[model samples]
Target: MTKTARLYKIERLIRQRQHVSFAGLLAELEVSPATLKRDLEYLRDQLGAPITYDRELNAYRFEATGGGSALARSTARHELPGLWFSERELYALLMAHQLISGLDSQGLLSRHLQPLLDRIHELLGPGGENDSKALMKRVKIIGALRRPVDATCFERVGEALIRRQRIAMRYLTRTRGEVSQREVSPQRLVHYKNTWYLDAWCHQRERLLRFALDAVQEATLTDTRAKDVAMRQVQAEMDTGYGIYAGGTRQLAVLRFSAQAAPWTSHEEWHPEQQGRWLADGSWELTLPYADETELVMDILRQGEQVQVMAPDSLRAAVRRRLAAAAALYVGA
Candidate 1:
């Protein structure tokens, strides 16, 4: 029998019986003693099966506490253990891997996922050749407003988050031109539009805060344990508002997209709480909740004349001033 088929059979035999003798496996598999020994090792070590030799019984039996046999313990969970995937599933997973790999320029994500990816490639077989690579080349992912992050900072932040420990950081905000030292208990790491953010409990503010990973000048894991904030409070503090700035009162901002921009804006999801309608004039009207107008204004500005802030006098006024300032630059030139 082939190595793969024999391995599967060996697992089935051992699992079905209370104890399986080496001679029994040898006779059934019709393999040499050395080959059977190697197969058993592969099953125990690589597959994480808790197979132990019972010298008293001269047989192998599954240990009470199975180490990591996904196949043997498949019944406990509703998943197959043998790393099996359909061709289409493999393609989808590879595409996802490609998308993430392209966006992970810092190699932080790629480094951790390399093992699983390697296993997938092995499963695809040598016949696939460069299919995965070619498919990756065919797909492209582009990012806007992505910032480079220091490896050490990312590593330290990840460590603190995993250990539920506090992190000391030197953070720089674009609006404030100086670095501020902070001790934060990281609740979760967020990746939005290619930028990394940490939703954390700010020790100084005594409240939850969001810190952009790129703006983190320095980060060090602390010995202190992180203060646990309720999940509901975190959601209320961070997920209720539009975009990343979700800390304040959410205000509804009404926007009108010109007919020229309707094609693009019609399909876009501005926000979960957003309400939109198609106007008779071939234009689109959208209203979304936002805590801060800073990011919203930037997005609208990208559309140039195609978008107009129709309601909330403050937002409308803010957009007008920014546009005027931008237009003034070309006046003298």
Candidate 2:
């Protein structure tokens, strides 16, 4: 058995019997005398377990009442609170916790997530006991082009979303280089591609729209309740696209990735409804539904010459124009 499991069982056995002999503990834990003694010492010293041996009885038991660290106090006469977890499961939980904690460093979601993180830490046992920091050190998530979410804007948007209320905000559109005041009824907050976006019903446009959380310059909740868009409508309009740029119209976009990029692009999840096939020339052909080509074009351009827009003349033309404009920048230089 693992040391953690053995330690937990040893504590349970001693607590159940109120006083357990060394022979009984050794037999139950299936550990050598010295290993069992070391385990007991760790519990007593490092964990602050109030353990004392009775000379007359020749058995170990709690001090009836002893005070120390929280772990020590809790496990004084009881088992550890955290349920046993396999190494793999513990790693998954630890990675998720770390990812969430990292994203919250800007304080955007800190207030909302503190209680949740605290509960998880408690259930996982103390960081020292679990070696959470060591586990976290082995894993890392890198966001190549990441943006931070605004804390004040996020707080207001989250409150409005939870209450199913409308909010007024000044949002900046990078494409147009304009900041417009809008009153929108928030439907959901989406964190996609390491960015936070708000899917809402735009009062000015009289349609559903997506606004980046970071681009929200100002936000305030309104007394008006939000309009409820059906789940079916939301999925059809928003989820049918390649990325956050969604619309009512949907079209199939075919893309060809060269052999060099195929190794990575073939394994990528570009879209849910995407279909892919390997060509004889060692390239990959991918088909996906898209409503707006804005985000799709950006993804394609990021791959440079390794990707090509195979079909849908409009998308191809758009990409061609963008590449030409970008190439012109180096012409003079």
Candidate 3:
């Protein structure tokens, strides 16, 4: 039998009996004692099944706290990895992996998780020349307007985030074209549109601020511990507005889309609390909150004549100014 099939059976047997003797597993699997031992090890060590030998009970059983490493213990709440994954489920996992791998443009995450990915590949195609690898090879994921990030700098930021440590960084604020040295307590790391943003409590600013990792030229972990903030305050400060730039006092921007753009824009979600409705003329009207106009303005400009800012004079003016500037570039062209 294939190793994948045998592994599935071992998980099933242990779960069904709650405990099973080594002799019984050997008999049921019809494998040699050494092979059975190897299988048990693979299940516990590789797959993190949390199955341990209860010497007193004289059988192998699931323990609430069984693991071979810190990584294993972290995932103890999950069932055995890929033991019961159907072909369709395995395909979903592959698709998700591809999406996430694209976000990690530096390939740091993919390298660390390659072993599990390889196991999934093997389960899908034991011969190493199968449809799974071929399909992945055929697909191309393009992240539009992506900025390259320094891998070493990003690693330092991630390490501080996971270790809950404060970091000192030299940041270049593109808007002002100035560099500043700041100490920040890393709170949350956000990945959006192929970029990494760290939402942290800026020690210098005495408030929450999100820093683009690419803009960060230098990051060094500090001995100070990260100041813990409640999730509620974090969301309130960072997630209440539209798009990636969500913060500050939110003002609703009402937009009307032309009939030509309604078909596409109607299905789009601008924010969590967005409201939209189709008009009698086949136009679409959408209302969403925004704290910053940087990203929001870019999206609105994309719609061109198909969209109009209907409320909040400030946003309307911002769009108009951007449009005027764009038109100026094309004058006499």
Candidate 4:
């Protein structure tokens, strides 16, 4: 039996009988005397279990619950909570672990969550303790496109967000080719397309900005409490538009996908507030609001001739120019 299982069973035996002899524990656990002794010591020292040996009874038992004894006065008895799980529930937990571990490859999240993961393995029943670890081997996470976030920066950013405090950051906006120092109140953290983003109210710009974590050169938590913006306002300004670009939406991009592309485009959620309908001819018509066309335009170009920007001349013209530029590369090839 695994040490955790043995420890759990030992506690239960003691609590049930109110006292259990060492020989009885060896028989029930089928472990060597030395192993049982180690388990008992671990239960006391590591788990804070207030287990004590009674020489008169020649057995082990919990210290009385009341604060009368020295052991009871220092620490209360610890109980290992029951972990009963249906097969399906266990599978779901394992799946969630796999996915979370994939998203958190750096062990940033895994370090804090390892204890809970251990408890999960202990639930595998008896000596099947290795089962969860074996399952972990079978499940693979491919993070080829993942952009690594600095561990220190991520922690400070997360701490400031949870503590409701402002943070100072030296930001590098690659798109603009500029580096600026700013103090911002982190409103939310977004993990989209294999990267982390901080949605914050930029103090310098005095507007909402989505700063990619990869672009944050440095972060320092501040004592000043974060400026709180209502969720409704944040959603309107930050989320209403397509992708990560932020602002109150200025225009809607209406698109029509060919029948072949409709099958896929109709089912995709390009934006939270997007509207889509199937035309009589089996094409898909999608209209979504956007404050900036930068991201929306790239998505359109990927479809090549399979999609068309149906409305708003600006978007159509932009797509045409991109297709023209891309085709120009092959002009003399």
Candidate 5:
């Protein structure tokens, strides 16, 4: 039998018996002891199956904790189809997994992603586990907000966004020190840097507004329903600002990057319409249309001297004003 066929048979035998000795596995697969041992090792490491030896039972058994064999089987079946994913879809899935894993670790989300992980492994094939581990080790999600977040508030906002429900929230505004209540139709939940924000249409204001989820002191779902806004329209509005608050009409913004930061900046997809032009001086120009400035400010600030806003006097003025305020902290020095 082919190695792949033999491997599958070995897996089936283990599933049927719960545990099987090396000799038994060899007999089942009609393979030699040495070949069976090699197969077991491959299954353990390559396939990420938690196979362990039981001295008392005199056999190899699946780990009682987090047995992933069933997940693996489901994953294999899904990948058999000729379904193709675009690069963006793949990246989005990866990011989603990373976020879910983080939430799971914190007890905010249930550990229900075993099947998804198994599918990822199957899609990745033999080298999937290694590649995933390596990629996760290097990539990290960081929130730009300086304050600590309330996990409950974050989860609530996400739930509301998913359910397509309007929410009544007590929000702490930056300009207003006191908490204000508003009924909002949540359009999207966005994570930028380390902070989470909800883009919603305020029923009171009759306009779109972005609320920092962490700043939400209370959020109660409302029974009153509204027309579901298209994600594209919401995104188009948001691209107008730096963060989530898209207060004005959409405008095109241009940014010139210093040579040192151009390479790293080019690797990111900042927005759907983002386009980059490499300059002769080794610098780069990135142009994209945006409707908001809140998230954009944080992004530009993160780049420091490696980037400069080239167009839209309003955005430049916003950046300059923020820099001046930051400089105030050093007045004593």
Candidate 6:
């Protein structure tokens, strides 16, 4: 801790306790009695205070001079709020400060938060510069979204989520090759594989759906609100799958992994309900219960020759049919 930080903590302790003994201040500030006395003298002499030790109180008491109250004088010298930050919080604060500072230089910091940033700078003590730089080097947070969403849309969605309001959105569906408008009760925003998605209850289809934020061309708030029962249902449905997409029913998905992929595959958590067993032939048997096949198929295809679908004949047939079609394309070429 730096001198300024120690002084700030001392000031906070004094204010909170009204009067603090030299021994208590020494323990809290972790400073020698001579140092604490010097600090007190400095506060009294330089800062214009009548801070003196009282035998009856057995602590230092701030006397009110004719000019102003002792509390007011000490506060005027340093008004920064003394907050105890955990390591995780410190890292988060450092990251946030870096982001805002970068955005400020680029003329993009939010107007509402600029004043708050200035106040933060005042609270940061002498060693804060070096501490912040070291923290920035050690910590990092990455956004998963491919492209940044429009700030305005992002703000609106956040507001909608807070208010629990339904939204009518104009969205482009790449899979269906269609642009359609639908009224959906916004449930939650999810991030997966660097993309942002909005999970909502579709009024038209009477089902829960997840739509990519980028795919949304336009959004308008609706007067119709989501019922508690519907929201719970959507939550329950989404919780059943690995990602946002969930099928109507759950199925047992079995996969066989080659020896080469077994070690890597065993270490990962494919799903919450995933279970794996080592086979005698140096292969691995893995089972995951999923509500959707779309995401599962993608997972299997990514493994290529290292993994094979074993059970739920439908999934195997789908994988084989897709692979055969892909192979036929290569043969024709």
lDDT of 4 by residue, 1-333 (tens): 555557778887887677889999999999999989988886777667788888887988887677576545324445655333444465567777877788756866667677777766655543455666677778887876788899899999999989999999999989799999999999999988778899999999898889999889999998899999997888778887778777754898899999999999999999888999999999999998888898899989888888999989988899889889999999979
> Per-residue lDDT of 128-192 in model 1, one digit per residue for the tens?
43787677789988876678778789888998888999999999988879889999999998888
| Reference-based lDDT, residue 59, model 1 | 88
Candidate 3 Cα misplacement greater than 4 A, ranges: 1-3, 10-84, 124-129
Per-model tally of clashing residue pairs: 0, 0, 0, 0, 23, 1
Give one digit per residue, the lDDT tens place, for model 6 in 263-332. 9998888887899999999899999887778888877988999999999999999889888887898895
Which residue runs of candidate 4 sit more than 4 Å off their true CA positions? 1-63, 67-79, 82-90
RMSD of 2: 6.1
All candidates' lDDT scores? 0.81, 0.80, 0.82, 0.82, 0.70, 0.71
Q: How many backbone clashes does candidate 2 have?
A: 0
> Per-residue lDDT tens digits of candidate 5, residues 1-333?
645556566666666677788888777788787878887787777767667787888987666654367435322321212124433344456667776665323434424566665666554445445766677666664433335457676666667777777888898887768788889988877655555678889888887777877688988877877448887888666654544456567787899999998888888777767889999999999998777677787788878888899999998999999999999999999
Q: Residue pairs in steric clash, candidate 6? A: 144-194
What's the residue-level lDDT of 145 in candidate 1?
60
Candidate 2 residue lDDT tens string, 215-315: 99999998999999986776767787778887757888999999999999999989988999999999999999898899899989999999999889999
Model 1 alpha-carbon drift over 4 Å, by segment: 1-82
**Candidates, ranked, lDDT:** 3, 4, 1, 2, 6, 5
Candidate 6 matches the true fold with a TM-score of 0.72
Q: TM per model?
A: 0.77, 0.74, 0.78, 0.76, 0.58, 0.72
lDDT of 5 at 306: 88
Global fold similarity of model 5 (TM-score): 0.58
* Cα RMSD to the true fold for all candidates: 6.5, 6.1, 7.0, 4.9, 9.7, 6.2
Full-model lDDT, candidate 6: 0.71
Clashes of 6: 1
Q: Which clashing pairs does model 1 show?
A: none
